[model samples]
Target: MDDDEHLLWQRVLAGDDDAFAAVFDLHASRVHRQARRLVEARADAEDVTAMVFFEAWRRRRSVRIVNGSVIGWLLVTTTNVARNRERSRIRYEGLLRKVRVETVPDHADEVLDSFMRPAVRGRVREAFDGLSTRDQEILALCVLEELAPADVARLLHVPAGTVRMRLSRAKSRLRAALGEDHGRSTLAGLGGTS
Candidate 1:
């Protein structure tokens, strides 16, 4: 037996959380790598890794340590967990296919479904393009890049209030170009207001 591993396992058996954490830290990456080899998605591999550790902790008393290390057992459990998850996923996909349903989108459904309409996007782009170069720069920095007004002012070598004013003017011009109601609705829809 590896004396360190034997001691750690004994501590784990004695219900030491730190010992279990140490064991997990020692083996988790190896288990995750094994799981990644067996599963298609990184997320699925991560899930399998978590389940392997959970199973180890849940059945700690029965977990077999091989060659004075628990890694061999953890790796085997990782494979089993990955296989079980893959089988469950296949069954779920099959059931979904059997019960597939289709529905036509209504106007409200269509509006809610899409983030922005193509026509609205075109108009917004056109409006943005029509702005002066300075306005465009200010808008891009403040809104698109999500920079703070103070940061933008520092970057442009201007006062913070000047940056805010320029941003306000750019937004006003865009709103005017898009028309009042349409612009407000569009901005609100996109989770922004000016």
Candidate 2:
């Protein structure tokens, strides 16, 4: 939150359209950059970025400005939006897999492998499945969405310090699950000798 941002927020809160546009101009590029890093698809990133701004506009009253740090809020929102998109993609892929399994017997293995590794991918999914829902969401938000810990905390409505602690626990659990001899065997069975 810089001085200019603070000023723009003041005007936005005062109901100035120009001030709102200024806010968009100031932060849109950074938002897009963050989205691109998370989504890895140009069009998807653009759409997500637009949704972030739209959300900001819709929730303008709730957007409090403390020392011009709206960027953190925006980043958190963008991360959540990106995560939603990822979830939607996963569901769509699952439905598609079900359809393909029923209609096309020849491509079942290939379709499953496409969703994950032929053999190794299952271990990865199993490790993820072992985590609690909150742990999984935190991991996806921080690791897959690539958001900063502070931003993740804001999005989850928890303290930044709590985010750090939860992330540490989640990492430890994932590492333990992935490091056991059985996990190693599973990985090997997936055809990844290493």
Candidate 3:
């Protein structure tokens, strides 16, 4: 949204590879961070981040800088990439289990467990698990990935009004599950609240 980003976007759209590289350099770290938060795995996050940029390059012509910022688009793309990776991982793990393969690492559970406090994380996970798949995806795209409703709509191929409506419903459900006070405190604890 800054002047530099606007200039870079203009040059990139005008077929300047250097401008595209500059934009990648500036945004890649943030994209990776968002992916990491959503997927909760460094390797998966890295893969998702790479895929996000790859998609950006593929869709470069269609990307617009309407609000002078490409960040919202980037975040939404990263969220989708992360979700895809997670789904694939889940399916692979299920297959492994069905095949009677040893899918568990000795330290894997412990490592993931250490990512959050037991009580707060448990409650949040419960809340997330209760939501419909659509609700979960929107919540991750908007709240976790920090994409605006319009950007989320663009990424998910939905209308902006639908995004707004879904987001409102998702928030209401999450709030009801966590309770208003506990939800605010837990979000603050997760560093998601301002």
Candidate with top lDDT is 1
lDDT of 2 by residue, 83-191 (tens): 9999999999999888844454678677656655646566677898999998888878877677888999999899999997887787667667888665545433433
Stretches of candidate 3 off by over 4 Å are 100-194
Name the Cα RMSD for model 1. Answer: 7.8
Worst 10 residues of 2 by lDDT: 185-194
Please give the CA lDDT of all the candidate structures.
0.87, 0.81, 0.83
Q: How far does residue 111 in candidate 3 sit from its true spot (Å)?
A: 44
TM-score of the candidate numbered 2? 0.48
Residue 153's lDDT in candidate 2: 93
**Per-residue lDDT of model 1, residues 1-194, tens digit only:** 37798799999999999999999998899999999999999999999999999999999999998888999999999999999998999999999989958886569757654746687678888988998999889878888788999999999999999999998888778778889888777656643556
Better of 2 and 3 by TM-score: 2
* TM-score pick, better of 1 and 3: 1
Number of the predicted model whose TM-score against the real structure is largest:
1
Q: How many backbone clashes does candidate 3 have?
A: 0
Clashes of each: 0, 3, 0
lDDT of 1 at 157: 97
Q: Judged by lDDT against the true structure, how good is candidate 2?
A: 0.81
